[model samples]
Target: MAHKLRLTRKHQVALTETAHRNLKRFCDESGLSPDHALTFLFENASSVFHEETLPHRLRAFKAALAAQET
Candidate 1:
């Protein structure tokens, strides 16, 4: 089971080719599909944004994955 919330946004930017590829690789490495991985991230974003813990690790993980695509 999962909780759902309304997430309002001011603007939406479609994913770039590089970003899509990077996210796909990250998802694959993490054993998740792109959609599932995104859902997972948003669900836990509160912990990530408010808490001063683990965001650096998450950023590093994303950076490493992004680096692979470049």
Candidate 2:
């Protein structure tokens, strides 16, 4: 059985208008609600931290930048 988690804390973040618009556009393009997108991102980051070695993470960052440039 899975343990239940409670929502006990919320944090507010401020985004520039351009960033806010971009987030909305990306969510629309991906067919994701903002909350779902955020949850997915958080879960993926947790998995990466759990399984990645320092060198692997560094290499991953380099790969991400290289992909962005193309």
Candidate 3:
């Protein structure tokens, strides 16, 4: 159910090691390649904002990145 896009747009993003690992895990669980997974998630990202734990999870992830920068 992933990777149905034509892929006309290309965006490059940098991820921390933790994020890279998390993405790999998510793609493995969902049976998606990284490109397809990114496409699917970008398209569906709006839905994530409605999750009950979204704020907490976002803060936790950001805090890790912030800590690394300091």
Indicate the worst ten consecutive residues by lDDT in candidate 1. 4-13
- Of candidates 3 and 1, the better by lDDT: 3
lDDT of each: 0.74, 0.72, 0.87
Could you give me the TM-score of model 1 versus the true structure?
A: 0.44
lDDT by residue (13-60, candidate 1, tens digit) is 489799889888979899986666676677787764557657787799
Off by over 4 Å in 2: 1-9, 46-70
Residue 45, candidate 2: alpha-carbon lDDT: 75
- Those runs of model 1 whose alpha carbons end farther than 4 Å from true positions after fitting are 1-13, 49-70
* Number of backbone-clashing residue pairs for each candidate, in the order shown: 0, 0, 0
- Candidates sorted by TM-score, best first: 3, 1, 2
State how far residue 1 of model 3 sits from its true place (Å).
14
> What TM-score would candidate 2 get against the native?
0.43
Write down the worst ten-residue block by lDDT for model 2.
3-12
The all-Cα superposition gives candidate 2 an RMSD in Å to the true structure of: 7.7
